[model samples]
Target: MSRTTATIDPAELKAAGTARQTDSSAPNADRPRRRFNWGKVFAWAVMIALLIITVFPFYWMLRTSLTSNSALYANDMSLLPTDFDLGGFARVFGLQSPEEAIAQGGSGASIDFWRYLLNSVVVATAITVCQVFFSAMAAYAFSRLHWRGRDFVFSLFLLSLMVPLIYTLLPNFLLIRDLGLIDTLLGIMLPSLFMTPFAIFFLRQFFMNVPTEIEEAALIDGAGKIRIFFRLIIPMTVGPITTVAILTYMNAWNDYLWPLMVSYTDDSRVLTVALGNFTEQTPQTGPDWAGLMAATLVAALPMLLLFLFFARRIVNSIGFSGIK
Candidate 1:
């Protein structure tokens, strides 16, 4: 006997297909779209408020820099500049002669602005370069090299982070004095030139995250540890390297106490120290508030520009380094 097959009805098949489609689409048809979250709105409001609070001082400094001396000390607080004045800036840059500066209602002190600025640039650049390079080498050894007592050594190094900079300042000053580097840019940069614990820790975390296979392959290709580090590891970690450089540069640039302690003369003084001295010793007139604000703005400009330019890379590297 031959076996027979039964065929389905077209109408029944069509109805079943329609039912399945309706069932699949039911959730979409019945579900409501999400409305904007009020919690998010509140959170953003708080953030904006905090941002304004944090940035208000810089804004005030810039505003005061543009305000005339009379406008700056006027009873009424004007958030915006009433009369735009360049005398403060001129005084800061030594653009006006003492006689002319005094004639223009400015403190007649001649600040060697360019000299201090150059000193800052040289010291900050040297510190950033040396610190980043040395920290990177230390990080490579800690992350990749096998050695006895490495962990213990690294732990001891981390302990340095706990020691306050104030505690070391006197000893560091004595050492610099012994070297006869006082009143020199080299003295200002010497403390930071070697390596910072934070920099090594930051870089080592990134270095550890690098794939071991890359180093192994480099080794198989007859590349030594130093060659592998320079070629393979460094090339892969530009983000972290640049992040450390920016950070180190910012620190060295903004450093006030150390530079002030080491350098007193205009020839060797950095921008921060110069600005502080200028503020304190304005001519027979009271503190030159507008000129001081102008000088402060000029000194802070580089760090602001640096952060604005490299902020994204800095944030990414910090996140990648597994630091909170």
Candidate 2:
């Protein structure tokens, strides 16, 4: 028996390995590399610049709030806080003595921050809840239920939106006065408590997109209209409902003109009116820039937190589709 032995060349093996590597990378080598996308880069740059511009004011406000009023004028242009002090917060809360406040360029008389904040909360909350609820009900009726003159009535509502808010203020004020609700929180909330035309329209659009089959199923199961609304429709449409509530709350919370017209005393004064009055009473020296900034931050904190908490919900709701 004879055995044959084969000897392989190292150069040939090396060449074969190199060929395999080349073959493996041939597709990638043939493919074109992506070029630098100047448009995308430019877009990102613009967005970053806009973000800085938008955020800088709030940062300045916070910096001023932390700065000392006496040194504020000197360091007005400084981007950072100067002579860090808590006296601004103290003045806002009435913790500083009149002499100290006056020395710090403050008004000496502290505004009732807590009381006005409470009044704002009450008014905003009442208006938001009531307006959203009534708006949803009205939207359902307009979108889901067919009735005589439904489109006509809805068009009338849309028309109301065109009317200037200022145009109706005098009439609203007179009505509130006649009801003897002037200088009351109820009066401040009454105008917006029912439903805004915008709110009704917004909800109606979403309601119309709801699937009829699901609603029909519920009806077959003997679910009444009210039951279906509260149990099924509301649950399914939580995203839009939350959006409506947030918008309504923001409008009510930021409403200054109506509250100013109705509320005269401390009992019904909202934060906006109180802030206006606070600035008006500035001393001969100047406005208490630090204290005023601090108060403004407090006034804006609620809305900031609200947006932060429900930001995802808002994003989701904006592109919501009712189809499963």
Candidate 3:
């Protein structure tokens, strides 16, 4: 040190470094949540609005169904029923007609309403059972069994699905007439009591979801195809199968056109066709709007209850089926 300055020492530098303990440019670790975002709020609002829009029709149908015809036709429509009468229900049960028991349709019979109901139940039950089983078996074969031109066959089935059902109406009628199944349950069921391309398609997708390993294990245990299917697959896929059953039941129960063509007798008429006839024949008596609504509600109740009961399982099965 030639020119002895009052040396600003290295110790001072170290002391300065200590004073300036490294500061962070980042935001504080502990801060309260930010204010509500308008964008997020709006998104939620839109979703709620869409849900209401989607659910409105069902609400309207229920409201109208519950409301009396007089109240229904009032100058101003009500979102809710005012009188809230179970008169409609009473009419459906046919209890009030006890004026010395006016025997409807002679032969001392208590009207044919129950007969029609029984016919509907029998026919719809038959269709649902046959269709579900047939569809499941066909779906299993398609999904698991490898064969020549399998995809081609599947493609052809899909093509059938694309064809408008109306296109087959004439042919179906002709076939029904030829088989002398016309005006009979066999005729009604003839059109497609045991087969549907859509059902096969719906179930095939679900069968694909089951693990190959589980099926292989069953095979290794010397289980046959039918045994494996009933024991392992069917049990595992109950949700989807139930969904199919529900859909099939609804379709069969609500069917009107084919039933109308075939079911001409009191012995064969289904509830839907009977209801239509009830509306059509303005015979001396006036339109029983309350009774009509009541009957419609009765016709609709089982599937509605079913859907409500299995809604969660239905949604889950639909998601798992890979149709989406």
Q: Against the true structure, whose lDDT is highest?
A: 2
- Residue pairs that clash (backbone atoms under 3 angstroms), model 3: none
- Candidate 3, residue 232: the lDDT equals 82
The ten-residue window of minimal lDDT in model 3 covers 100-109
TM-score of 2: 0.83
Ranking by lDDT: 2, 1, 3
Off by over 4 Å in 2: 1-45, 315-324
lDDT of 1 by residue, 58-102 (tens): 999988888888776665587788789987898889888889877
State the displacement of the C-alpha of residue 307, model 2, in Å, after optimal TM-score superposition: 1.0
- lDDT string for model 2 (40-70, tens) is 3455579779999999989988999999988
Candidate 1 collision pairs: none
Local error of candidate 3 at 170, Å? Answer: 2.2
Per-residue CA lDDT of model 3 for 214-251, tens digit only, reads 99998999999889778987898887788888877878
**TM-score of predicted structure 3:** 0.71
- The Cα error of candidate 2 at residue 122, in Å, is 0.3
